[model samples]
Target: MNLTVDIGNTRTKIAVFNGEQFVCEEKFEEAAPQHLLDMVALYSPDKLAYCSVGSGQPAFETALQKLSCPVLHVTGETPAPVTVHYRTPHTLGADRLAAVVGAITLQPETDLLVIDAGTCITYDLVDAAGNYLGGNISPGVEMRLEALHTRTARLPRTEADGETPDLGYDTETAIRAGVVRGIGYELQGCIRHWQKRYPTLRIFLTGGNRYAFSNAVRQNILTDSHLVARGLNHLLEMLP
Candidate 1:
């Protein structure tokens, strides 16, 4: 068995895989050492792959070292199946790269647009030849809402939940609808923009906010919440 850990901006995700078969997954507000240790004990995975877009907690690092298995920390330079075309590969986020690898793994030899909507929304493009062409990053749903409230005096802090009608009826609904619906529009526009260039493009949506905007995207798109974890496992398998 293999274990993959993804520490995101606001949450941490861990998954267990039996070869290429996904067994289970868990999420936490933050990566707690004991939680991970318990998972390690329960799964008894032979290999572990980890990547983080969040702060590298020292305790978590210590816990990882205590594990008796090989641990692969995925960095920008980690060897993977895709050929990276980004000018500054070192600056690319591991989660974004992992998402692309997961996309290609699921759908090979095809132009892909991997959209990961977590704390930030990322759109990574990969050609049919497996060249990662870089991507764009934008504020996520919560960030957008927080920005609206913090950056301005009158705008009230709003949560993502609520009826997202075509137009908001009240202040809370308005903020929720505007932020959520705006994201929907942004995603739709991006898909259209990419489609013109890559007609055979296949869209893969992942991350927490994926389902929130899935219905908004008119085109056919594949949604996998565990994309980054799957990709991390794939990279572990590729290790020489």
Candidate 2:
């Protein structure tokens, strides 16, 4: 068994995998030593793969060490199952790389556009030849809403829910429509452009806000909430 942990900006995800099959997963607002200890007790995984975008927490690291498992901290320089073409590989996000690897593992040799809508909206592409071409990043839905509230005095920080209209009828609705619908259109446009370039391109959507915009995205898209975990598991398999 293998354990994969992804510590994101707002949440931490832990997944247990038996070979290539995902057994179970858990999410926490933040990772703590107790959380790691509990998972270790439950799964007793032989190998662990971890990736984080935030500063390392010593307590959590200590807990992982106590697990007595071979822990692989995924970095840009870490050996990946895919070829990285980014000019500044060191600056590439570990989550993004893991997501690409997961996509390839799921679909194998096919052109892929992996969209992760989490703290940020990231679009990473992997060619059929397994070369990872860097993607773009934009402010996420929550960030957009927060930015609107913070940047201006009158605009309120509104939560995105319900149906988004093409145009806003009032102030609150207008903000919701602008942020949610605007992102929907942006994602659709990106998918369309990629499809034109790679006619057989496969689109995969994941991350926190995937459900928020999945219905609005106008493409033959596949959604997997556990992409990063799966990718981390795949990377773990690559180890000797």
Candidate 3:
């Protein structure tokens, strides 16, 4: 068994992988490292790996020190099997790197497009030949609303859940429709453009906002919100 942890920009995901299959998974808004340690003991995995893109590493490190298992924390500098070709490899987010690793692991020798719709929507590209080509980031649903409210004068702050309006009638509904549909269209456009360049592109969507898109008409999208953690486990298997 292996414990896989992904400390994302917004949330922390912990997974217990029993040979490439997750037995159980847990989520946290802010990672309580002690809870992670307890979880590790509960799972009793001999190996642990984590993807840290935030400041939760200290607690993770502290927990690892006391654990009997070996914890491998992945970073841009950390040794990975895949070669990263981002212009500034060091500046690349761990989540992006992990996503790429996850994409390639899904199927090798395939052109991959990863769309992570969390606080900010990120679109990353990897060639069938295996080079990581960079991506685009745009404000997501919540960010779009927050930016409008915080930056502008009158837009009200809104949350996404409990009966999302399919059509915009008034202010809040209009904002919701615009943000949601705008992202849907934007993601589709980007995928279309990228697909034209690489005829067969595998599209995978991850991150929190995946639920916003689970249904409601997407042409060729494969979603697994737990992709990052799954990818971390995949990377661990390739390790020496």
lDDT of 3 at 106: 73
Per-residue lDDT of 1-240 in model 2, one digit per residue for the tens?
Answer: 899999889999999999999999999998787887888889889999998897877788777766688999997767897889999999999999999999899999999999999999999999999999889999998899999999998998798775577888888899999999899899999999999999999999999999888988846789999999999999999999
Report lDDT (CA) for all predictions: 0.91, 0.91, 0.79
TM per candidate comes to 0.97, 0.97, 0.91
Which ranges in model 3 have alpha carbons more than 4 Å from their true place?
A: 162-167
Residues 1-240 of candidate 3: C-alpha lDDT, one tens digit per residue: 998888777888888888777678898888787778778768889788887777556766677667787778787666554667777777788788788788777777888898888978888888888778888878878778888789888888866643446688888878778778777778777878988998888888888888687564276778887778877888788777
> Where does the lowest 10-residue lDDT sum fall in candidate 2?
58-67
Q: After superposing candidate 1 on the true structure, give the runs of residues whose Cα lies further than 4 Å from its correct spot.
A: none
Judge candidate 1 at residue 150 and give its lDDT.
Answer: 97
lDDT of 3 at 103: 72
Q: For candidate 3, give the lDDT of residue 180.
A: 82
